[model samples]
Target: MKKIIILLLIITKISLAFEDCIDFFKKERYLQAKQCFSQINQTDPLYPYALYYLLRTRVYAEEDYSDLLPEMEKFKNTAVYSYFYLYLASINRFKNPKLALEYWSKIDKEALFKDDIPFYYYLKYQIDKSLKKDPIKEAKKISLYFPYDRFYGYPVVFENINILSEEEKFNVLDRLAAKRMFTKAIYLLPYIKDGQKKYLYSALLYMKNREYQKAEYFISLLKGKYRASAVYSYIFFQRKMSEKKKYFKELLKYNDKKLIWKAANYLMKKSFYLQKYKDFFYYSQFIPEKSRYYSNKLWFLSLYYYIHGKKNKAAEILEKNIRYFSEKPKVYYWLYLSYKDINRTKAYKYLKKAASIKKIDFYVIRAREKLGLPLFEGKPMFLKFYQSKTLDMIAKLKPIDYKAAYIEARYFMKKHGVESIAAVFPELAARKLSDRKYLVRYAYPKPFLKYATDNLTYAIMRRESFFDPYVVSFANAVGLMQIIPPTARWIAQQKKDRNFDIVQLFEPSKNIEYGRWYLKYLDRMFKGNIFYIAGGYNGGDGTVRRTLKRYEIKNIEEFVELLPYRETRYYVKYVYTNYKAYQTIYGRK
Candidate 1:
């Protein structure tokens, strides 16, 4: 009995130790994880995973591929035997194409994890292409596995994309457009050589570039009535308010639903700047009742009427539009208020329903406050660290090993829902081994963090790259902070660092240092307004300043919502949101 109890205790200790190792692995402390895995007994259930990680850390993370032969030999007959073959193929794929092909052919791809499939296909294509396989067939076959956005070890050289046939070019163009790589899509135009496709691509490129005149010219060249006129009107709709309003009035002459839909969208945004209740209410007639903007328009209309002391109009609009905005707690709260003067029972019913729903948004908190319930129960219990057997297998491969668990966490969040973001936010923020935390430590070497406030720094870092040091944005922004090469050079010059090479921007410590210094600089320029700071960081200082000058921003919220670029508008909001989450997590508030 004493021996059995001792054995049980030992097992529990090993289990706890394994969990700790996994936490280190998840954190990307590969060296420490390797150490932890090295100490595990050979007979343990997790021993295979330990051995795999130990070899992987040595080869991939440490970049000491010299003595992997011994380790490779040991894993050959194990359940994870395929990984040994894969590692050899990956390292030698370019240098020894024949040997790499031999290694690749040894593996059973079906036995690999789902995330590993893309890497396998990508590597196989490279190997096959290097061995002089038919270019057309190889391009078509590999296009199936092409990632929408960037991925580790995916060859992004323009030559690879340039070789695709015309049909394949269109297919890849569609995918590139979906990924918002419009600039890269333009590269395919020379090869595409079709007039209509070239015209469409030109219009899209100009639109993306925000050169409306060029956009209008190309859009005019489109053949079809539906595509041409709609795009032409959209160009006008995207212009200044005065310009768009004139186009909107002219588009009203057309009986086309697309034109009408565009007009309604225009009115919805325009109404905010007009800010006249009566004018918007009058204009609301043009918007179709079934249009997506209809409910949001009614929401604004009802609120405006209530504010203007027209309770009858407010109640009428709210009652009619309640179904359309049911998911919005403010809608329920407003509907309750609308019923207050006429029906006390109905008012109480709606209020009660509104207060029952729990969310962190303004209306939910207001409803809870009105009901005398706690504003929130507590911060969410973030989902527990999750691991599975397949992840263990995936973690055995180089480079992919580093991202495997992190990718699984992302997949887990998607499988659950958006609410899972709160549960996984910390993991997402710190998932990559070379993430912001690693970079920030170098930036703030002293006892007290400096340059930028910790929360703000974290927010910017998360927004920039989600801690991916290797990330290069479609706009040619590089490294963890996504600093464009021109800006990086300027930053280098400003710092008077003569040794600053453009390639060094890809280095984590250098990237973070430069990024933080720029933030400090922007903080001075924007006078500490985070909205302006974030907007400047994303959409150039001049753009942010020009927008601010153009409009009399009623508040920070108004300024953020009305920013010219849709991407920059959301960029500020997301960064601020991330800052708040960082404060909550780190108790930095």
Candidate 2:
């Protein structure tokens, strides 16, 4: 390896293909580099360079040297011979460093590129010093090779000192220290590549020796740059410098956002653990306003409100930001308690309002169950259209597929039931549905000017099903609104004054009308708790009501924190997302 590196360093006639192969080899693409080297047209005079690459390829490829051994015999007694010998010696059979050193020793140091001497010395130094055989002999051997090397350069040549410099020594020390090649690190210090490595390694060595003062002096060089490196992170954490906690204030100057966030949280935690709230406040600007984390921040301060005996101010902080919760239900639940403790009416009102929307389903269901009200949900409505087999099907055959459980609406339609249909009605969100037309035509409140005039629900339907006239879930729900057949039949009977069979629920028009009515009922019954509605839609109102019995608790936050099931959690999220999409895309907020 030393001979190869040395040859590489001085080659004035480097072939592009050889360089390309080297690049590929370093990238770990051994086969490609081998191929590049092999493909280097024998016609080129640089075949020796290509052959050198091929020699190294077998090492990386971990292939038997026999495949390339015949070719190796041709390169004996040349500059290449030394490299081949060194390469052979490096192949460990049983991790036998001494045996490998034998082949390396055979290298004719007398027949080498002077520039290759440092690399050779370094590799030999690594092996000898690592094995702890004899440092004095190894160091003396290193000097023989790197006589020109500064500082570590010793046992003078008959001529003046060699060209080795301070910088070279520093780098060598850096490599040795980094590799945990401690013997080499200590012995090769005068040849280190830079003073920083000397400082870093000295600090590491001192710390290992429990010489804290020397360690401090070494890392103290980093007074200005310590904040910018992973080194600080290692030192601060691994050293457990509890007393030097104040020193990390300098780390704030580092600009890595991720690291900063971690640092900020760490500082905040340290302050809390140390019972130093004023210290924690130093990073108040980076604090997340989200309830869970911010609440923790408040808890850490303790003096913010609770500790100061100003319960009212703390309660107000919770309320003003409850609705902005990153974790909705949990946040609202806390705010509910704060309000209830100070003002009962406000708390109930806030609780009811929270129950209406969907973020906090468990809490909402429990709230409605306690209130003896039916579940709240956006009523499902199936669209029904009747026409002879002659009418043309629309281009968007089943837009609900695009809904992908994502709901949206159609503004204008011109097929199935009648002439051009536009969902411009102000009252309902969109056009009339088709599932159960019978219910819409008769039961749609006779003063019914509202039914005829409003199509607000139609817009909501688009986001729900995309007007797919026929759809069903495993629950026996059918058609666009995804209404369960039994539920539809019951809803239809009350509105139309006539009972209908479950099969008729498949009819687009009848299914839609009944579905829409059920949706409206759910919405009103649960007082707008979107969460309960989505859950009831999937798991049924009975399940929600049943769950509520075990849900009562003094801490509202504790009540909602306990609901399990990932799907229900997301079900509530998407439904509200649908609501927001409807409002944003169609302006029906």
How many residue pairs collide in each prediction?
A: 0, 63
- Give all TM-scores, in the order shown: 0.58, 0.27
Query: How much lDDT does each candidate structure score?
Result: 0.64, 0.50
Candidate 1, residues 1-589: lDDT per residue as tens digits? Answer: 9999999977855665766777788798988787777777765545655666676777657466545455545544333556667877887888888999988987766446554766776778778778887545544555534635356222432446666666666777667666677676666567667577677767776677576787777766776654446454564537576656555665666567666675665565556545644546555776677777777677667756665567678878887667787556667777676677878887878787777775544345556667887544343223345554433433442123334434443453444443343222332434432222112222211111332447787778777887665677778899778999999999999999999998888666688899989999999998999889999999889878887786665456446655767688778866875665555446564
Q: Number of the top candidate by lDDT? A: 1
lDDT value, residue 369 of candidate 2: 49
TM-score of 2: 0.27
| Residue 366, candidate 2: alpha-carbon lDDT | 50
For model 2, the run of ten residues with the poorest summed lDDT: 400-409
TM-score top scorer? 1
lDDT string, candidate 2, 1-589, tens digits: 9999888855723454555766787798989888777776654534544666687887777766655545645544334456666666656423767766876776765444444566566556556755666545555455444544443333322122233355544544444444444454454444444556466666665555455676677667754443244344544444464633544555555654555555566667655434466767875545676423565455434324533446567667766655444545544444555566687887777667656655324455455544565434443434454332111111122221222111111222221122222222111223243221111221121111223222334433443455454455544566556776667667767788475777665554565567567666776766766656655555566645554554443332332222333344455544554444344333543
